[model samples]
Target: MIRKLLLILFGMGCVALQGQLAYEGVVLDADTGTPIPFVNIGIVDRGVGTISNENGEFLLEFRPREVQQGDIVRISSLGYIPRKIPVSLLNDDVLKLIIRLQPNPVSLEEVVLTDKEYVEVEDEVGYRDLLGKGIGYWKDSVALGGELASKIRVRKGLRRLNTLFFNVLHNPSDSVRLRVNIYEPADKWGAPGKNLNESGRSILHVLRSHEILTVIDLKPYNIWVRDDFIVSLELLGVFGTENISLSLPAGNLPGVPSHRRYTSQGSWERIDDSAVGFWLQSTFYTDKPRKANKPRQLRKREKKEREISGTVFEIISSGRSEMRSRRRGATISNYTSNKSVKTDEWGRFRIKAVKGDILGVSYPGMYQVLTKVEEISFYNFQLYPVKN
Candidate 1:
């Protein structure tokens, strides 16, 4: 009887010591209506805290007995000043806190380019002509108009992945990596650690300082696959740079993609003015089209003629009819009319070309070119080795 009584008393005591407590709030930029993310929030006295998710909301749980109405809460984050507010002010079990973070002042040292140092060409006419050409290749149709479109059937066999849209600055010497995060509708989705918000932030960090591309040609431009929304950092600066001139090929810029179906929301475009060039996104809308007709099986004899492969190198002005010869100990190669030729250890190669035929050179997607051959001979051609 005594044991039973003791057990009842202990249970009551435990219940009495516990109280229900919860903290909820919306975090926003004090200056703008933007929601603040990844900010750290904590109850200073109890040593408990939580970070705000992408939606700028945070929830922290505590036993009411462990926290009082008058405790102080601390909030902080990078690129922003921290603040503390009294718990008593957290009225009605829900709170709205507006925080303002000052932007970091950037200070770059002025660097001068001397006459001895070469400068690239940058004019509106040059790039405009280049991008206007039909540039890349898809499965069947050739890519055109600085935009590409293809009807993709999202069947059961297709992999499920997040759709993304991207735009870039082009230069000959740089490569940019872009990352994006998408947030699910807050009303319908709860905070998931692996959601788009974190992914976008991670990508932004990598894009801070990237290498730029110095040149471009057309052959590699056709090699871009449909899945690549990630723009290369190397080609970004080519669109426009201080004193740099961009020379586009005779046709259009290949591989700029557009939606095949009118159902898509829309895509992005590069907007340029006399002063600068930037990217703007368009709204994409699409309707479900009828199932596509199955393509007829192809005959084995009918094969694809397009072949893309090569190493990166520079073209020297030394050659009278062609680019300069490859240097010693080179590993790069160039595409010829009939077959591709690789450089020897000493960077020498004897390759064949036909008069009036086009010879394409390529390196990654950064640069490529198709040259019209006046004559086919070893004497007219040379190669440069690629270090990048």
Candidate 2:
């Protein structure tokens, strides 16, 4: 009976699922008639989805009670046209349906080169520090082609990316294959739009057992863009149970927001305004960035933001700039008062903490620290950057 259920779950048996609906199919190229692997197949925003494996086969099962009216299965892939089939029509078809996706490749026009004044500049940008624990399907099996992307700001003029770096955070699988994609901002919403990778070949990387940090060389692809763009990593295949996450704790890296799309051709959904946790090595022929707003002097700032009736602990950097980078917005939690406050530019924060109250401080790139309030005169706090 267990073997029979397995066959039914994989769409091999004729018996229909009791309380679930399963869509099984093999996605193929319409022109070449070859199996198209890693195709996205699922209903929009329903969280009911699956991706075609390397052989172009997939099985997507969902509870029929969970689907709302007008929901359709969206089948999509990079450089291919998307197809939608209504939920009611899927049950009418025979099991193991064959899907053909037409190629709708967008062309990149050739342009003539001209000599112009150019400044060659390069810098590294991304959320390298562990601000939070981890983001994504923290510890669960996820469909193939599920992507987690972060928006990266670039300078004016053309920018070329050479290296892309991100952390796995948690991967229960022994190995997981991933694809790197760089996209121009979508016109209507400024979300991840057109695929900027000119090469027809997919940019692929493999994370082996015990490996955490991943760095991919993008110099060969010659990826160049003028405006800000999004960098995303797509799940291709997992050797074991598919459990992974890219999010971190800390809640720092405020400006960059992360974006997510469940499967190939699915709609892009903004996960949160929080960090995306991916950075890159950027080279551009553009002028320096505009000067930022002048920072308010730390001492001159008004302390009247809140009334503090307890000891004031100054979080000083232990000769590391990482401590200062997160100084202004670092989180200071007063477990005693059941309240929290952000640190000022000088890494100083005042909270209501009496004797024996526990205080926890968090900053990017530094280990989280907790202190038990002692004598008022001995409240000196110092922190160092976290080592890799």
Candidate 3:
């Protein structure tokens, strides 16, 4: 009986080893045959994923029980067509592949422009020590085509943009390349809308530490923004494989109100918890009246007007008794104006908001609720606990 048990144990071990799957591959550009780094590879709907290394090489491992026979593996990269393959087709326990990705075709739109000299319309300057975390593509999974965007409110129509300048704290030891993209705001939520720039290949070079002020010239590109727009910085590539651990420094500025926002999952969101703001400045030429061209003065006056006319609204939360303790820090944010406030210990909060503004209520373990501000004040919110 002991000899038979040992034989069965050995047989099970061999079967387990045979069930293990190891996949190795290199991602390359189909046209140039050059390796594409930081490609995102994953099993569809399985939540198992990995990124290719700097050399475009990747290894994916699956335990006997983790993978299904028909599970599909997906490979995707920015500006490249994504590819998918089935697990059953990979016959060998240890399989190798050289996957090629085709570059996505990009059409350049014609930019209409009237000749104009760019003037500094708006500026936000207050750079403290680097705030290690602001917002950007910092992880390998979202590194390719990863973007961070800042919302800039423009009161008047603009003829052309001159330049955008911002400071970056570079990792002096490593070299990195970044792309700058500009877009029109999609809606009141501050998401990126249409690509305003003709070419998305604008690159910035990071050389030294001590707050390198990178400038992006927009004159040659003929980009124009009428009202408000978003400026985004995209992480393109890190120079060497050894420098994979290094990330682009987050732009830091002294705390300013309602001007900072970022995106990591393709949707823009505000940065509220901290006082530091992302360092971003824009210079452009506006064709509107001189009064409309004075953004800083206009903003100040508008803020004062809002304060005078703004209505104070109270929010109340009613939910399950189990979730009452978790609703104290619920946040009330105005999506249109970017103003935010928090609920108090009693789940009550007051905010000065104007009509036509969209308000969102969010809590840690509750479903977020959005309501449009009307002409009245004193609003009550019903908070519901999130279903697991």
Highest TM-score scorer: 2
Tens-place lDDT digits, model 3, residues 177-295: 66666777676655676767654334354433333444444556767666766666655555554343333334433332222222122333465323222333334454444633665
**C-alpha TM-score for every candidate:** 0.25, 0.62, 0.43
Model 2 off-target regions past 4 Å?
A: 1-15, 110-113, 117-119, 130-137, 187-190, 245-251, 261-273, 287-388
Model 3 stretches astray by more than 4 angstroms: 1-24, 31-97, 108-149, 156-162, 168-188, 191-204, 207-212, 216-227, 232-287, 290-388
Clashing pairs in 3: none
Summarize candidate 1's per-residue lDDT along 1-388 as a digit string, tens digits.
3122111121111122245455555567655758777555666636356556668776655565656777867665434556676666544423334444433333344887644422221111112223333332212111111112211112222122221222123323222222222222122112111122211122221222232212222221112121212221111111122322222122322332222211011122221111111111111112223212222321211242333322334465444665644443332322222245554554454544444334544433223344545544433233433436
Candidates ranked, most accurate by lDDT first? 2, 3, 1
Candidate 1 lDDT trough over 10 residues, lowest sum:
274-283
The best candidate by lDDT is 2
TM-score of 3: 0.43
Clashes of each: 61, 10, 0
Worst 10 residues of 2 by lDDT: 291-300
Estimate every model's Cα lDDT from 0 to 1. 0.33, 0.64, 0.54
Model 2 Cα shift for residue 322 (angstroms): 44
Of candidates 2 and 1, the better by lDDT: 2
